[model samples]
Target chain A: METDLGLWAVPIAMLGGAIRVSTPILFVSLGETLTERSGRINLGLEGTLVFGAMSGYALAVMTGSPWLGVIAAAITGALFGLVHGLICSLPKVNDIAIGIAMMLLGMGLAFYFGKPFIQPVAPDLPAIPLGWWSDLPQVRAALQVNVLFLIGLVAAGVLWWMLKATKIGLTLRVVGDSTDAARALGLTPSLVRTLATAAGGAFAGIGGAYLSLYYPGSWNEGISSGQGLMAVALVIFARWNPIACVGAAMLFGAAGALGPALQTIGVSSGYYLFYAAPYVLTLGVLIATSSPTQALSGAPGELSINK
Target chain B: MTLPKFSRRTFLSTSAALAAGAAFGPLPARAAGGMTVGFIYVGPKDDFGYNQAHAEGAAAVAAMDGVTIVEEENVAETTDVQKSMESMINFDGASLIFPTSFGYFDPHVLEVAPKYPDVRFEHAAGLWTEGMPSNIGSYFGYIGMGQYLNGITAGHMTASKKIGFVAAKPIPQVLLNINSFLLGARAVDPSITCQVIFTGEWSLAVKEAEATNALADAGCDVITCHVDGPKVVMETAAGRGCYICGYHADQSPLAPEKYLTGAEWNWAGVYPKMVQTMLDGGTIPNFLRGGLADGFVKMSPLGPAVTDAARTQFEATKAEIMKGGFQVIKGPLKDNKGNEIAGAGEGFAEDDIRLESMDYLVEGVIGATS
Candidate 1:
């Protein structure tokens, strides 16, 4: 019997928790990285993410296939992004303000439509059991990483490579660095930025899918919490790098898992305080790395936040 | 049906009427025609948890002949709830209102209850103290008794003798439940220990899921929680093949096979009785409280997995609670920190007011309050 795990369970639990917790954040932050790289930011990804979760869960429950639900979430997320992109591309529209409005709209719609699906059970995303050789059940459980997390890892690497070596990535960078420069080079900045933002929304939608179909795996109004909004800060902390987003997301995941992991071994006195670890880690990293005099390194020149 | 909307003109006129009523001593209680009762929830009504329990109550009340129930869901604990209360009073002409969420009591209910002295305000959980508005009343059930019952069932069902509790916050109410659960389990098997994890938010599904998995990973064969929405916790624990003991509402539908039993609020029985009292030209009690005997709380039917021994023990303990003066917290008790909770020859009874300010997990529970 593995009833008395003692202190050894904390690290193993935290490791499993990190992968589970970080997957959604990683997806959203990577999506935001793509959008921010093109000189536009979709703060509305929070709304899109939540909306995606609802749509994904509802679809998965209907289709009886988790993969179909993921696809449905991606499509809906892209549509939300398209709406954000189309509105932001208009003259005198503030993407930030529109993002807030879209967030409220998305949440409102989800709450209204999601009322029916709260009780129905949806099929969950599969996990790959990597701890086959381990005799300990804790080790086996910890190593059962979800497939979406593995996909997030590959997506991060691919996004990083595309941003550095692809022509499409170069067009995005050119449009993001200078609208006039891109226009002179016969590239339409608005069209490129809109597509990039939509693609980013697709990624965030996938993150939302991971949330409802895996880890906490249920359809409810409070499912996302502030994971969507947190990804915005995460993008900044990652310095707009997809690869860095994965690391930062895991840091947050580990912090989130810390309190619960300690409780397993009876270090639970101040367990509630541990939930704040992620936010504190984010604030600490932001202060330690940011300087008042310099523009943030690797920041998109035409990004609205920079302006 | 939609709750009556407050137009700008209606708001101004209602404000004037309220101001005038405040100065003119008190408006006469409206006892004519059908009465409007407003119910406000901090989350969606179908959340399958705390709000759902109250919503079920409201649904029962709605079926009454002369009662018109108006409900607004997803009302936050901020001034937004105050606005909802005022709207229910003004636009909907609600004579009595139930701001059911606990957070709505402190400033939201206290702030709004005084402004409308004629309308009755009932809050869930007995937070009403003297010098607060007389119009505002409090009512709650001793659901800890239900948790203790759940603990008895869990203790018998657990092969590993490790029960897990996923709670939200370390408040007195939650701590009391944790202590009672451990105590009940100890009654069955003295060596059984409860591992508790507080997720901090009432409805943070991700953390609740993580906590459940963590408990299951640590070899807890049975799991329960005090979170507002137990859907995620129940589903996750059942997914990992752990026996689930639900809270706030009946969750057997979520985990049919692995569910042991649950602690559920019987607001359906309590709410209508209170409404009927007011409807019959009677004053409702300001500090109404009860347990299984009074129908304030009820336990879910024992699951198919429950043993005959567990069922016998659960029914016996429940009868004791219903018989009244049943002391879950007794003499010679210590918290998880090895500090005394109840010294020898001293203990808090089932309805002890002192238990409301509980600040420690009892001995045999693996958790801390701070």
Candidate 2:
């Protein structure tokens, strides 16, 4: 097969790669956004993401349904979050340290349990061929979007709305703003943060499910590649806003797609440099957004690390 | 702020002294009174590719007499690997250790080998030098021959004369496989051109899939790869309806419909032999190299997608390779940049060190190593 699509194919392929790669990041960052908004940071979401991937893949392989695998992943992720939440809720327990410990636990458990699920091919999540209207093969292949990506977009919108328009959102916000204020308002800060962390973990887990059951569609140790950690940075970049997380994830995805996209255009020189695009973009984002004198204006007042 | 800081030279000397002391440490007594061999893998045991190939070999040796196998999976090629080796030595009392990843050769294996001179160390796909410790050995198979055979199948299967190669890195071992595959394909169809994409990392599943899709979108009817795991590449190519030739292990099960064949490591054939030779009081060669005749590497069974003619050709090539006269990286070769690698009348021997350090792609290969 000799494709003569030429220069036009680069952006099209990149667009496709961006959608495929960003789905996980979108889910994870959205999850991180919720956690950070509730005055907790779960750095162990990387472990959650990996465990989710392993659980999702194993369940999908066992059940022959990718959706069930996804649900399993979400549940597993939520459980990890719950553990992190409970452990950190104890007096004098640092959330950051607990998060790091949980992350290791999640990864260890996943690696230990994911041993048998490595080779088996699980049912893959389906993709919608939005590119059917295109005459060009490159365009058509590039436009084949997975269903999870749409769900992620909807999740972003719903999360954004929930954060602004609901009583639960107000209570969570009050809990995040000040524990004293929450106590005065007769709210349990620990319970609220724990639920938020669990919710965040569930979102990260769905991202993991997307990795194992959708795009790359396989279970392995290297599947996450620090995307879970990157989502933490992404949350900061998004100012802990769920809607902005979608945009940030897509941007990261586009950066990641840059190398392969250039290769299609016959740009092979210095190819390894292009693989650093995402990391470079992340550094650039941090440099642009961070102010040394003060925390980013949108950071919750009760967020201990910011102090 | 009040802490004392050591000078760079002082720090270096102290660390060097510590390493040397650790290296020349007194030998610990064996507890089990039997041969215990340890195998460390950089990936999962069932990655269906690179690590799995080694694990299979480990399993082969595990069944041997008086041998206790202590296996550690997901061991990275960093200082962390040194800890795993130490644990295997100090805890499991392993007399032999196989740190199988390519990157484990330098600091990790070198650092650990001297510490336990009594223990034999065999690293896979390593470049061992004269200056390295005597107890350390390197073993690798000529899997490029299998790649060449797989290329022949791809050449016959592809109607469009365009093939895709998804590679982990542009290192010599990977480049050799890519070039050999292209050479074999060109032997069948002179006009066949292979577009190669390097994913930079050994196990970036997402990049592997994207590269496969990009290749398919570019009209590459046939695809192959040299990544740590071929699962992503194989599945993506099959998903994109492209014929695939896998690497490291047989991935036909992943994409049976679109699978053409694969170049696989036959570590099972050599691991037992190596261990048995050592058990029988024979020295394991410092640099062990084997070819198809020795059963170090073998081609996967041809898939339904492969034509009968391609199979016949593959069999003939296999027979020739087994007869000990086949050399894939022969002379009369020119790199893709049109530089003469070998003159028309000259070629390197099968075990040529030049092949080990191969830096350029052969003619008909489309990609830059840089």
Candidate 3:
């Protein structure tokens, strides 16, 4: 069972595992950051993620093109988000409640439709080998980054730039900051928020695609494992910043990779505890950063969550 | 049926009669006019994993003469499952109920069984004690036997002499399968080793995939898993160009060229017999266990990737296990931690509670229990 490699392998494996594991979280949290920035919370992205996973995998299997599957997943996610946005726009409708209901609906639909795709294998997304210089097989394998991870990194930068510099970004910020201000400015807050939510859903759909069409690369009911929901907490931890979402996601992925990394180095005691490292770290971050008496810094003023 | 207004003495007499009936009278049958069986699954009916395995079993029983089967899918192991069972008994008039999830046994089954004494409850993958209720019985397949067979194949095919296992938890059943797989591998090549990773979830696809990749990166040439569903593991490993073995169901179709063999549940072989035994008014044993010999477990057909030598060795090992007196958890066994689990010539019988409660990995298993 012993590998001849020295002690340096653990950190190297974790770095690679972090990149692989964090890709989904990065995409999902970035999506949530957009939605929350526009003063809405889509708790139902969990469902969207699963639905996207199913739709993405099923389409890849049917179409034999992984990119097409990703597009389909994004479209499906956008549709789910559009539904949530339209429903929540009704007078006196609670977005949080609707988000929960939509989550169940999305998951139910995915499971119902995903049954046939469970046993079939879908085509995998291609990966870029980045470790050609390394002589060690472990290093070479670890550095084989998936294409989606690179896309997610680019998406993070683009989202940050768009949210900060674009006119659409100003409109979303104004609407999220104060609905009354937006109405006075002749802009419909609901419409802006709805579009933002849809875009968010689209991003989450890609995250789901990453889960089913790349890393795990299979369609099943248990594909997402609450990563969609975890992105909500991750967004909060990132102070609703898209760039910070990437870092936060990498932190989570690194924590998740800790157990396997340690095992590769033959440090296997309390393995289950290591599995819980991500959650524990998330909890610790939340407790340390949260203020009891004041709204969180950088929180969108019109956002309904936790207020 | 209106109740008659009764005087105090009449009420007392009626209460006494009811108490006497409850204490000494034969329990009424739960089913009213037909044999109705109910199954509750923790996942969708077609998950191609543990739940699907049970669903297939329920379908088999449904095919039996004069038997009707009703199922509630995606039921969690909570009070919600208890409610589903009650409704099946009350509305569907199901006499026999199978709550197939592992977590359903402790509080849910134990709490519900006493409320409906006439209804027989069969739980899968449970540890039943002597003091447990008589109406509730537990059964599980010896999947380790099939896993061992797969291990022999893995042992022979692996050029690296390192195999990877993606396991769900550190529970005894899972540990037993892991150890047996390693033992079977080492039986062929004494130097073979298995590197295991527990994903901490029964059906988390992403984690299972990551673990599979991690193992492959660590130089394991062959990979198998004890996850609730083997879809992601098989797919990930195969996509990574690694040879794969599966669990819970046959997954060769997922990756034909990379597929080896899988440890599959043969619940269809046992469910009909169980239903028949119940229909014939026979008591099901409190602790029912069976293996490949009795058809409760099976091996998926070997794929083209499997060599003829591995196939021969696997078949011979399987036959030896089927002939009885072949114990996988035998003497001179030391845990991965170097502690002697069983000294030379000292071993627990197959199906022994000690074996059932296995807590350590055998030697050459590169994994931890905690």
Candidate 4:
């Protein structure tokens, strides 16, 4: 589909692709928000994303209900994170390597479960046609959004408030900023962080399920185009703020949509190079904003990745 | 429309129950416990390629007597394949299981088969996976026949003398296809070159598109893909104003302009026959490689762009194969190195091609394996 960028359609396509792109990131970054605030990092969300896509798509096809498939996916993802949490709960297993192993295991599982779902039309997700609000033809095209996209927006706001205002959030942050501080205050660092990781894992699973159950329903080995890992990268760019994560996720979305947008507008040259927009934008953003001292900048203390 | 969020998409319920030829077949369940069949696919059924074909086959079975099928797409790796298998057997109560990927043969199907001796497993692509639960069988189409015929078209149509072939992985089955396609392409134009690109993974649209564009830039006018998804070779070809033959399905929509033609596996026609065979109290033969004659495989509709000469030639080649008169790797075949393949009318045995764990490339195809 050659998106005509000059006809005011390019922006519409970008707006549409932006939401499509942001959904996966919203889920992953939200999960990361929970993780980073709780003093841990599950760098294995990429694997979780793949596995969730596979499992969710497969299960949805099997049961004939995409929602059940989603639930099944969430459960699988939580279990995956639980394993990560349990592994990290013990001493000496680097959460990074364990995350890596979990990633492999998650991807492995997704591939296996996804076998039969390779066929059949997945039940399509319902979209809210907010385009009706605008009589402009372009607005209609631009505003054809999924309910989950809106839910993601709300989720970002609620999560942001939770981190800033809730006691659990404060405690988790305490444990994250300084396990010693939490311990001095009689708080359990291990418990708070473990729960956060599990929550993050669940969100990652939902991110995965979103890919299969919504934008492109049904299972396939190639269903996920690295949305999970990109979400993780997006979290770093979001500076651990769930609200900002949405904007960052959408920027990445716009970048990804640029290639198709350019091709859509009758300028098809260098089309292959357009696929690199997200990575290029991502690199540009990180270089522009990242503080030289990881700790001196937006990074939370006690996160294993910074160290 | 507050599109009430429902979780899954259900194809028509499969009311399928068939008699079991083998002793370990499904015991006739009560009116409620009819036949339950399970399927494992390599990609989402909606992928419109490999898994979708098999799912349609399974759905066809569901359309028949007393069968209830539960299909799972996007099964992760072998371990999870085994998990999905086990769950189908123990939990979903599937009497028959089809793991539609060749990769799932050993680690997944074989590992789970012995545990459920009462259940039968029909696996795709496991020439070796034929043994299991005394009831397991393997099925494959002679797709090499279609690939060879498509080659006749490729050879006849290409003016640039260059053909591009994109593939997913270098497994033996895929390797055989590349060999057959090249062999056919060379049959018509001996000077024709087939440049191959490996996407490393299956059905990845972006990578497929990128690699395809690079090939097109190098002046390859004719293209083909063993990979899944319309987002790749088909779309890229249409956008770049090139021609391509599709695999697995009639992907003409993606490249209506450049659609050259493709080979499609008629699992719908082939699968019901297998179910009937099981019901008729007959055991499936080992190493069953079904083809056009057997109705497991068929050629897709030629696209508008495929010339009459090309179609006519391909049709003739296809007819010969259906008659069991054509052999791809038969003697007078020379290696790309100009060495005699078997020397003076010697042919590659079914073991060499059928058990075909081939690594060598035929003449006219160029690429390297890292």
Candidate 1: which stretches are off by over 4 Å?
A: A291-293, B1-32
- Scored against the true structure, residue B263 in model 4 reaches a CA lDDT of 76
Instruction: Flag the better candidate by lDDT, 3 or 4.
Output: 3
Every candidate's DockQ is: 0.70, 0.63, 0.46, 0.10
Candidate 3 stretches with Cα past 4 Å from truth are A1-4, A285-295, A305-307, B1-33
- Order candidates by lDDT, high to low: 1, 2, 3, 4
Which 10 residues in a row give candidate 3 chain A its minimum summed lDDT?
Answer: A1-10
Model 2 chain B poorest 10 in a row by lDDT:
B25-34
Please, what are the lDDT tens digits per residue for candidate 3 over residues B1-370?
6657755433554466467557856324332345989999987777667887888899899898788888998788788898888867765668899999999898999998997899999999856779989999999988888888888989998888998999998999999889988988988998999999988888777678778877877788889988777777887788767898878988887888998888899999899999899888898998899888889998999999898899899888888988976778777989988999888888765567677778899999998887
Q: Is the docking of candidate 4 incorrect, acceptable, medium or high quality?
A: incorrect
Each prediction's whole-model lDDT (CA):
0.89, 0.87, 0.85, 0.72
Error of 4 at A155 (Å): 22
TM-score for all predictions? 0.95, 0.93, 0.91, 0.60
Report the lDDT tens digits of candidate 1 across residue range A167-223: 998998999899999999999988998999899989988988888888799888889
TM-score, cand. 2 vs. native: 0.93
Clashing pairs in 2: A1-B219, B331-B347
Which ten contiguous residues of candidate 1 chain B have the minimum total lDDT?
B24-33
Which docking category, incorrect, acceptable, medium or high, applies to candidate 1? medium
Candidate maximizing lDDT: 1
